[model samples]
Target: MSLLTRLLERNLRNSGAGARRLYSNHAEEESSATKHEFADEEPVQPPRHQKMATDQDWSAVWPGPRTFQPSVVPLPLRQGYTEKGAPPPSKFANAELMKIPNFLHLTPPAIRQQCEALKKFCTPWPKGLETLENCEKRFPIEIKSTDYCHALPTIRNPEARRVTLNIKLSDLKFDAHAKDKFLRLVGDRYNPNTGILTIVADRCPLRKQNYDYAMYLLTACYHESFVTESWESSKSEADMEYYSFERNKSKQSAEAIINWGQPVEEAKKLNADHGFAQSVEQLINEGENVYNLGKYKEEVLKLLNISK
Candidate 1:
């Protein structure tokens, strides 16, 4: 708007115009130089191709899904058990046992309670049972019994003795039990009559019911040891036709030897019941030693004991 200001402004514009024109010319020169350089260079042969002479290595190829190994691995085989304690058969007895007739075995004692009748029948052999007369110890016979009840007082004669049974013989289930009872009773040497039959018949081991007649009959069979008359028969004396006295005596001896081994009187002792015998021998030796040492004048008479 003022004259001097206009004159200063015109001089600034004219000076700035030369600077701007110079910068513009410099930019143009740089672009031209790049263009000329590009034009002078030959275009690159599109890139040299390489034909790979070796196989492509895929050793490092990674698996798509990651997996983990089991902590408890699978096994081709596993472990278990065997039957170790099976029993061996050889040690046991499988023998076919001798069986008795059912009538003889299973019958209630009422049927077999005939000790008196059997004694009556066996009466023909006063020396002993006729059938068993020629044989070893006669097995006491029990026959088909009748239900006759009677009282027999206990006998204490030396030849005849009486003992009570733990269980009644007639009440046994069968001949096996009867035989066991008989053997045990007869086995005693202290006495022959250690068997007793009871009307009490209780304590019968097999069925436990009492057989009064059976008990009495077994008692009578046990009585056979003493009452010779109970077994002695007028008939037996008459029937000497079947057996002779000399023959009977020989038979008795043979039977005794066969059944009881020359009587218990002939059995050898295991050794006289030495009892305190060894203790006395030891005391004597000990006393002798003390005397040899001259320790006492009396010579230890404790074993010899002289004073009254």
Candidate 2:
């Protein structure tokens, strides 16, 4: 447009070109200086694991439980969270592998060696207590307990305090009155068929204290059962909760029906019929089960001489 404006535009283009040519030498010098600084430095080499010899003892290498060491372990282990379709990372200093404990010391050979070393500290088994029958005969009372372990803040478990004491009812010698009182005191803890009396104690906070409490209860029950009160002596057959026909009027009535018009002494002398009556009494006392009732009917017919 104007002569001055045209001249300024041409000079600006020439100045840019001249500036590039002038800085070319400076840029090369700076680049050369950077190259010289790093030229003597070599590329870093990765850490290498020492190759183990074939005859090396593994027990000495890994003596106890410890974090997994990829450098020490001979196997090529791989661990780490991988994205879908991607392979897991190799086990060289892997965090996932190091976090968990290793059971390298628990090899079969190591375990056998440990057992042999500890054998001197162990006591030999009692000679005569090999059989279960002999063990039961010697130790009549059986004590049962439980233990629990958890990875929690507190190590104590409430259930570990409970203790159970079991003894046979037959082992506790008692008269009829004492036995009845003892059974009443124990309530449902007594298993009549198995004749086992189980006593449980858990009030105390410790296992040993609870065990001692259970033994004390058993001792108290036994001593209290033998001490007959005035009211206990006055208890009659009518007051009995469970029926025993032999000790009741039912046995006499059945005997009279089978031996009518015979002398009381002669009826008592009838051993065959008397045994049948006793069997029938037992069946009745045990409740009217179908098989037992049938057996009872057969015994009754035989006693009465009733033919088909």
Candidate 3:
């Protein structure tokens, strides 16, 4: 059975009986009138354990008045920050690391470290995708298993049967004049689920240097079934699209960032511009100038799509 199917069946079985109450509330009896402060007792007694209907002995504890404590929180504290432990802001102030050519030069440990980061990003797969024979059909890019498996996997635990992606830095696309310099992966690992292989760069050298991208892949799946299965200290949410774009930032509505939270719009704009639209724009702007030229003139220009 699929893990999802198994989970649903397990939930259904537990729902019928013997499960802890899905929601529990404690009610306290309220007094109609506040009693006046009593004279101090001749001997202050040490607090005693209070045992009542539930039959478990408990040490006396107090927060708000026992009666005032609500049977349930007045409003769910949901969506408010519980805790966000991020590296200190200064840790990211150093953006000059990219000044070094081949910013992703990796030692053996570094490569292993990056592979581990990739696995962590892919986590919440629980057992890690088990069946991979059919995965490459789904993602937009293809990822074949690589020969580097013996040296890779999450650094925490390198497995012999693990998937490997051994792309060279030279294969990544970059333009010295362009603001966006991401090296998108044709990542080499296949996800066992959905049978679709997708490319997510094994290492965004910039992320390690605290330089984020503005145009990126769409990888976040929050409120997902596997959210609980994060395998590393970083949650699976870390796998979400990360775009640190310069141009698109000004167009962002407040909600596009703080609310929707992924780089969806920015990434769309980016890939659109670079992959296809830029060529179209170049053709549109230069066509008239090129057409009015001498030898390669009217007939050639007419035959070209400039007329179409």
**Clash pairs of candidate 3?**
116-154, 135-195, 135-196, 135-197, 213-243, 213-244, 214-243, 214-244, 214-245
User: Each prediction's Cα RMSD?
Assistant: 39.8, 10.5, 36.6
Off by over 4 Å in 3: 1-140, 149-200, 204-216, 219-308
TM-score of each: 0.15, 0.62, 0.15
Between the candidate structures 2 and 3, which one is better when assessed by lDDT? Answer: 2
After superposition, the stretches of candidate 1 with alpha carbons farther than 4 Å from their true spots are 46-308
Task: Give each model's whole-structure lDDT.
Answer: 0.39, 0.82, 0.33
| Local error of candidate 3 at residue 11 (angstroms) | 99
What is candidate 1's lDDT per residue for 137-231, written digit by digit as tens?
34433232123222224322322222233433444333432354344454542232544332323244322233444556556545444433434
TM match of model 1 to true structure: 0.15
Query: What is the total number of backbone clashes in candidate 2?
Result: 0
Error of 3 at 49 (Å): 78
Q: Provide the global lDDT of candidate 1 against the true structure.
A: 0.39
lDDT tens per residue, model 2, 1-308 = 69999999999999998999889978999999999989978997543345677667777788787777777877778877889999889888698777665677898877888899999999999999999999998889999999876545576899999999999998888997789889999999999889999999999999999999999999999999999787866788778666665577766777667667777685364434565756665676677788788887788788778985
